[model samples]
Target: MHRTWAIIGGGNGGQAMAGHLALLGERVRLFDVFSDTVNAISRQGGIKVTGAVNGFGPLEFATTDMGQAMEGADVVMIVLPSIYHEEMGRNCIEHLRDGQIVFLHPEASCGALAFKKLLVEAGNTADVTIGAANTLLYSTRIITPGTVDIFGVKHSLYMAALPASRGTRLEEAIGSVFPNFTLCPNVLYTSISNNNAMMHPAPTLLNVARIEAGQDYFYYTEGITPSIGAFVEQMDDERIALGEAYGFIMKTLRKSYFDMYNSGDMSESDSLSALCKKVVAYREIKAQKTLRTRYVLEDVPYSLVALQSLAKIAGVSTPCIDAVVQLAHGMLHGELDEGRTCEALGIAGMTKADLLRYVS
Candidate 1:
């Protein structure tokens, strides 16, 4: 059967996904509330993809109506910012029909868990399955209102359904679309294995002065120096420790990047600078034009803070992660600690065993 896919964001990832699915001949209905992206797609007749994914992906329909978008859809892929997951989940709950799957593309560190809680609190009774992708399948950007530039496609992506039981069916459905994705134990592995938490924040934070100075440099190639690489490795240690505490084996940034991009030989001693030089893809990725990029605002709050929140409960002291989170708030000039925490995710009071059962 040709399953219907309703992509619920019009951002870069959403556009790229719509293009990929439509290119593969899947029925697609894309929706966005704020941006004119869906509207632009309707006007343009299709969403165009350049660079790596080349083709026009037809949208069977595009809309801002939440209900209309979800009508008869098999899978609803929520590809929005982590902070908006709850609100989006709430909006989709009532309209989502039975047996529908809500897959968060790149859960940005346990976004699916928070979204699941929102679904429950919203009194959702439908037999809907919820799952998450550890990271997006592509490095993409909206080249224009109705076009996306896909730089690269991930070779391996992690996904898992909540409660662990719904994974196999969800895996088959998604795998039919994207065979690159593989199932993990659960969303905990998906969340903690998010490489963005390892790769994004520190490089941008360390390059804040350059971003402010309007330096014309490609972020990965020119920004991620040896010093930054060493710092990121330590940051990875904090994440790995936090995961180990919970009995999940998190992928190191080296292994994660290698699996995703497949161009770097990141050995134990290979610095970020060396890995950057080896990966040809990094050269095209430019630094953020401004200091207020998602690298800090999004990553710090949703990624690092979420990690530290779990780390605290797991009795792991994350000095490097904590320092970066503190530095990011200071640099961004706001209290970002109000991001998705254990308390916010309804896991603050649970013991380790209880937490395992809750997610399991």
Candidate 2:
């Protein structure tokens, strides 16, 4: 019996997951909010992918209707942004049955915990398992509405569960499909492990003028020279310090990038420089001429802002993180932290003891 996998969002990430599962002969269902995107995918036969992975073919299923897409799915991968996870979880509360596992990609800032809370709030407590991938497996792009180009899958992707008891079972479920998945100690590690909040926003926000000025640039490689990379490393160090103060083990941004790019056996310096090369190659292949990546739009509120709150509770000073957040706000025109903050996620106002009580 083949397990059915449902990937929501139907964007690059969703399409890539669906394509992989379908290719493996699993039943894969894809859904998105935009009808045009769905129509484009269906009309084009399937998503066309390039680089390390390649080929284009038909998907097992694709739909705009959420409930219909989730029917009979053994695993549901929420590939959408962190903001949508809560509502998606609520919707699943009514539809998801026992034995189904909902996996949040990257689980930005403990999003899995919030999603599970939403499910509980909906007055439904079926034995549906909740989990999250530490980071998105692929660094990809949607060349067209119907095509996805996968850069590579990260090594050492992490996962964890709510209530801390379902970790093993959820890991077993997701591991059956993605053998590379590793179980994290808890959601806190998985949540804060996202370096995009630290790395992406700094460069994108700092280089906003250049981005807006149409100065044809590739951010990580060309825009982030030695000095900029040094600043990024410093910000990453602050993030690690915050995690350490809370008594957690967080990987450096360099290691995270190396893991994502699969640059194994490479020295630390070699690994970071390799990552720079990957970023450059990515821009060239995609013909990207702007700095409007998801680092600021997706990473700031989801990852960095969340960490800032955590640092406050842990009594850690995150000067670099703070500066980047303020800089991102100044550049972006609005406070990304307005509605979604640690408090909004139920972590704010809680003492360090209270947080450790849950995480521990």
Candidate 3:
């Protein structure tokens, strides 16, 4: 079946999704707040995709107007950074219609919960079913204004709806376009399973001098040295402990990479750095040239800080996680705060069982 798709946020991930879906013969509209991006895409007549997927996906329309982009769409995919999740949610609340599915391409952590909170706070009862994926379906980057390079697509990924009851409906509605998603228990499972949080911040923080000095290096292979990789492993341990406190068994970052990319076998003796160096898709990916990048800004607040908040609620201590959060705050000059905390996500005082029941 052909579905009408409204792709919000015309950055790297959004362009890849809109272009790929259009290549599949689905009717697609692209939306972005930046007029420059909308105009550039419009001038090009379509998005050019290369590498793993190759095609020029001609969009039905490219506009800055939210209402126009979302009008009569069956699926709305928000593919922005988690920092913009709330802003996009606010922009979408007034435009959303009933029976429409709102999916965060990859909700850094607790994004669907935060978005659902915004909808209820505004009293917009549109019966919208909101869901989120653990990670993006493709490993891609934008080559230019209207062109993208997709390194690879994931073999499988996890997704879940806000209310546990709505998981089936969301899966059925999105199955035609996203058949690789495997439905999990609830939003907690999806949010707490975020591996980007485990991988991005520590390495970026450790490589601050290289980034500021404009050194070009492979982010995963060179940026993640043996010690940096071990530090990330410690943070990953805390993430797993957080999930345990909430009664879910989350996969380690190394194991998750193996599962998602089918990269290679994992020996119990392999170090995190060694495992990362073996991934073929990550070989050509370059490190950030500046300190003011998403690796720190987006992941620290949305993923790391948010995980710390969840850990506090679970009564689990995360010394390694806290250390990175503190360093990010100090180095970035207080810009990173307790973002998407329990209070912000509307689960402030809930116990572990209470959180389970709330999502259930």
Q: Cα lDDT for residue 305, model 3?
A: 74
Identify the runs in model 2 with alpha carbons over 4 angstroms from their true place.
40-50, 54-60, 144-146, 257-293, 335-339
Model 2 Cα lDDT, one tens digit per residue, 123-203 = 777787778877788878788887778888765677877656778777667777677788877777777777667657776
**lDDT for each candidate structure:** 0.83, 0.73, 0.86
Tell me how many clashing residue pairs each candidate has.
0, 0, 0
Evaluate residue 251 in candidate 3 and report its C-alpha lDDT on the 0 to 100 scale.
87
Residue 249, model 2: Cα distance from true site in angstroms: 2.5
* Number of the candidate with higher TM-score, 2 or 3: 3
Task: Write out the backbone clash pairs for model 3.
Answer: none
Enumerate residue pairs that collide in model 2.
none
Order of candidate numbers by TM-score, starting with the best: 3, 1, 2
- lDDT value, residue 150 of candidate 2: 86
lDDT of 3 by residue, 98-186 (tens): 98989998998888888988998999999888889988988889998789999878777889987879988777766656788889899
Q: What is the C-alpha RMSD of each candidate to the true structure, in Å?
A: 2.1, 3.3, 2.0
TM-score of each: 0.93, 0.86, 0.93
Ten-residue region with minimum lDDT total, candidate 2: 280-289
